[model samples]
Target: MPNAVSLAPAVSAQSVAPAFHEPLHTAHDDDAWWRSSVIYQVYPRSFRDLNGDGQGDLAGITAELHQLADLSIDAIWMSPFYTSPQRDGGYDVADYCDVDPMFGTLDDFDKLTARASELGIKVIVDLVPNHCSSEHPLFKAALTAGPGSDERAMFIFRDGTGPDGSNPPNNWQSHFGGSAWTRTLNDDGTPGQWYLHLFDSSQPDFNWDNPAVHAEFERILRFWLDRNVTGFRVDVAHALVKADGLPDWGGRPDGCSSDGYPGHAAPMFGQKEIHDIYRRWRSVLAEYDGDRILCAEASIDPLSRLVNWVRHDQMHQAFNFAYLHHPWNAAELRGIITDSLQAFDSVNAPTTWVLSNHDVTRHATRLGENNPEVGLDRARAASLAMLALPGGVYLYQGEELGLPDHLDIPDEQRQDPTFIRTGGERVGRDGSRVPLPWRADEPHYGFGSTSGGWLPQPEDWYTLARDVQQTDPDSTLNLYRSALALRKQLRLGAGSLSWAADYMDTDIIAFLNNDVMVIMNMGESDAYVPSGTVIAGSHADAGAEGVLAPNRCVWIKLN
Candidate 1:
């Protein structure tokens, strides 16, 4: 049995409770402020637009910092805004140091950094270390230098005749389907050699084996830290290192393909050597104040093994995707939360939870696309559950308002490279990437009248717009504000957590911390309370509850 953190003695439900506000505690230097804080991810292209270019930019983000501050978010994880050809939705970096002109100038980034800091929110940018655009100067140099040239060694290059002259160097398939290797013909007009790409052929993988690569990335980290950027959300971080020797993956009956090749379970990508690299990054982060965080994007399930990446020496946290993928069920959610807490406790490593992100379907759509109330209720429940956990939490943009996935994208208007590659079987992320609706009546939903959004805005979003919700006392946005205020007021982030006695009940998910008990119902119907007086809930009436209501939550004071 796990040791539990005891709750403070009971208080009356009718007492007008004081708000919870306490300074955040730090576990170590180079650790993320988000460990005990709430972070909201802003996919810049979809967050807001100030310039009317029909795209979101750094300036737009700067303009919207107050919205996040208003919600009491502790930090912001801005997606990649670096120069790119948009081949992989800005994941393919053309320049690491400068902001893409489409997003705005370096001056704009400086302004955003300063404004976010002023608002008390840490800014963490996405760091894509695994690959760069095929148009990158390094790739061009590799092409011009030919095999055996030092530049050619910067990336993986192989020359050989396959079983069939038409086959690739290996059987690996790209994440977007088709062969992972693209044949780049030599300048001599001879048969082209193959280069590896894990995703789009336009985005080639980086070779971490090179000393120059590590040094270059370290310098990049320092550049941002020096500029006051708090930290990084490492993209495909596990792929930084790859297995040597480029061995062919053995065939599997499970239909699993590696890189595009059948049976390629190469240890190269998630190799243990990655730890050494993480340690190196950690050391650099320490040079600053150790307050900087390094969050990894490892999507593997059975989160136990993934937590290893966060055990003090490697990453500060790795986003857990399993719970995000599960269906809404009382038993399932309870098991997941309980098991995850247990796993994190075993290692003494803090955990991080995320329900929606730029890459996944919006939670509102997951709950029930047509029923806004259901979606809003689920959003409230999810937020409450996430905050009550003992570790960190991340909330995607527009999630607080219960934004639903935009299913109205026309076939021709789709922009996601993944959807294009998969022939639309895979829902492109464009639906979730729609511009934020700041005001229901404003032109372009208050994103910008003159500036056209990169992705189309959902017409329905206007109904749930920020400005509209701000006026409604019972709106989801206000609920989020209240939830965040309560989280801070209770000093919940700093308090130790324990599974309460009734925590395992299928209908109720409860946790005790100091004097507070947070209980949530994942069921689609009202849940009966066994004990405890409700202090705050998804209701104005405090003591009248019999069932928790579909997707409702409560923060209770135990007697």
Candidate 2:
């Protein structure tokens, strides 16, 4: 039957893709591997423990590379494990070259890289460039120099008497709360200048305007590439460049001061100059051997701006946060997916999808808090929706096990800087950072030997233990394996595909790619699709008619 729909032929054995063989610098090779890559994020603090220190380290992660390999993940995007004062849980990096003591030494990191390579899993580390800890040597030098010093220019330092000394140089708010600036004592016992921090006071903003800063960052990038790091997950990538001249962000209606220090919206965070910075970074990454991935965590609203980050020459893929924050509903889910595809199509850039991360509440907790069965079912559906997409897909740790957020931490035990400064009005991130359960019947739930791990393990984690799930034929782990294998066999990432919104109405979203129709039932009731060859699904058997039960998904191949 020669119908309008036909399956695209697989890549020829002799016709090599340009990205795989060419140097990364060539336009033909940029963003080559990511198109089909499935990235698995590992939050080190909670992944595993090797030394019995109650904290996960490089050795622990290295030992578990086989586990990731068994799941068929192509790459691992690890959160920052750099040296830090633990102010922002490793986000505020003090040194880029060295591994944090708590995470083991540089040798351990190298061994982990080698082990992951052996398992065919690429390693991507989080790169924090926008800011450094207040204790960083560069910031310390600026503090001692006071005003009119060369080292002081490395940061945004303004004297108290900016015009009249009554107002800050500009209006900007810290993300945590209150002003973004903090005053320190000068060597002469006089009022010292104020330093700016977009996040917390302890994380002082870097003066990217300084050439020294640019050169240092370039060196850091090269250092990692030389060590065989597969790529980087750029942290707050859009915030790298700010307005050359600090300006007032106008007064806030919430009664909080909008003065440039913190808490107020400022235009400098996403300046146009950011593109130039990215180009320079990309140029350096080109020097590497393989197709090095660059995933940006640019928290920009307005889907159009987000698409810009993934254009031909920009980031390989920028995090799509629409699904993370959207309300769980049939219409909302359909709209987000449709809009995302349209936005990416408009820009000719591939799209990426992430349902949850360490920063946000667990998806299970968000959807299953009231009805566990429904929530788990919905979680499975969401995973299917994301995996079937055209571009890359990211799976946060414990997502496969259906782990929910654990919010039983005492107020005094809180560790997140956001919670500490906000006074508990907002839920902290501790709930999502709990240890992974390796065994259901172990005394400590197989997290570690200690009664209390780095973060408290959820009581419910025992049921979702890795050992138990490995044995269950219908477990989420097996489902992920099946989905990944199907995707690989189809080679959809390298094929030309088009989707129509008319077929994707509320409660049901259907899209066609390379002769494959992905039908998703976002509602609670069963849905039907025209008969086709079933490629993958949650059902035990695939009948001629594609009937999907509540929160079910099926990929059908049309002849």
Candidate 3:
């Protein structure tokens, strides 16, 4: 059977065929790999540069799997490397089935996946489903076809409100930094129809209400599945479906803010109609042999609503962002962990914990004042704590190096649209996406053989580079290496967690995962630890006997 699907008449059948074999995908029971995996996110352009073109590419990623495998992570969740103008860091994909030339060719991607598979590393590529590069052939046709044509129906195009059709249809706003609508000139050189873009103007939203959109995405999925990729990390997972009537969202009068518009109950995002698409996608994955997985980047509020996307028949794992947003307080962290675990447990889905990602500030910078040393201590402690919890985990690139956000990147060098479009009021995500420092002595710290990466690296990064810390037992890099080794040895990935009554202090979080004791002191003073053999510690201060230092944590073995 081919991966052909029919549109529901809202779109014309002539636009796409209902039955045809383009490609195929299959799955296997193979360890239920997603259940207890530690997945690392690789932002392609900033990870490594193979050709020293100062741009990271597929060949660079393929060459770096040994480092990831050595770190003991089970999988890799790579950011988008598809062809695009890079208006939004590759999230605005122009092609679904091919890799961008800057990232390398399809052959490079296939070799990367094959190498990762050989290392027992599952490859989960990013899939941008909500919107696409406006340059897509379908969207180009939509612009050329004008109103009432099947091409125009492929996207969310509508007539403007004013008499001359000069005003937008509603009050929606872009998630990047401006109005969600962008007007285009007609083929005849006259002002024409408006199209909705949830983010940048170059990235236009698709009409999921249109059947052609549904069938097209299904084929896209099969195209990658045929390439032997393990799964997809869906970008903007929940905002795909629009509500009835595309009603007014009461967004800002200026039509742009740092966080963009509210999505809690907005007509454009978090609608109930989105899950049906996932359910269909889930069925398609099941058609294959392996337990092909779907993980979401949905930012819905309320643990209950967030859990809805991870129901047994929908996605397998959804990022537990609530846990990430929690401050470094013992009670707050514990409360979020309990709530998140309970919510996902109810759905029989595994909770995925993360402290840093491409979209936010690094935890080292987030948990402390303007103090890098203090921030590093808290970040190391937090990493050990998150790894011990009973769920999967996501480690962002450069975080293991204890890297902090580059707070001083020059304005001219910054590339994130969020920063450029917001008129500099917001710092945006570029600071956190700066190139990584791999060698202490090399220019750009070994991110490339010659020049600095596409994004510049700060001078201070040399001290935290991989070459400086890889051999040091007490370095943050080595600490992660040792902790993950122990995590696997203890089988802490899926287990029951309980608070240790005797080890509890006002700001101390001491929990037992299965039987191994995990302790963290988030207070201003030292806390007593119960009798047990110390296995691992975040910092040298945790080396003291039965005493865990402030902003330090340790894993203990107790039978």
Q: Given candidate 2, what's the lDDT at residue 473?
A: 77
* Model 3 misplacement above 4 A: 1-31, 251-264, 502-505
Write model 3 residue lDDT over 52-77, tens digit each, in one string: 88888899889888988999999898
Worst 10 residues of 2 by lDDT: 17-26
Against the true structure, candidate 3 reaches a TM-score of 0.91
How does residue 76 of candidate 2 score in lDDT? 96
* Top candidate by TM-score: 3
The TM-score of predicted model 1 comes to 0.89
lDDT (Cα, tens digit) per residue for candidate 2, span 407-461: 7877777788878878888667888888898888975677667667877776677
Number of clashes in every candidate structure?
A: 28, 13, 8
lDDT of 1 by residue, 1-559 (tens): 1011222222223333323323122222323356577889999887777778788889989987998999888899999999999987899998999899889988999999899989998899999988899988888899999878889778877775555445677776676766778888878887667888888989988888898888889989998998988889999876777677766655331223444543225544557788899989988898896488899997544566667778777788788776776566656765676677667656666667788998888887776546766766666777776776657788999988878888898888888888888898886788888888998888888988764566777767787899999999877788789888877777666566565553354455656666776666664444555455776676554224444654677777765
Q: Considering TM-score, which of the candidate structures 1 and 3 is the better prediction for this target?
A: 3
Q: Against the hidden reference, what TM-scores do the models get?
A: 0.89, 0.88, 0.91
Note each model's CA RMSD in angstroms. Answer: 6.0, 8.0, 12.8
- Shift of residue 281 alpha carbon in model 2, Å: 1.1
Query: Runs in model 1 with CA error above 4 Å?
Result: 1-32, 160-165, 250-268, 369-373, 503-505, 530-533, 539-543
Which portions of model 2 miss their true places by more than 4 Å? 1-31, 161-168, 188-190, 250-265, 495-502, 539-546
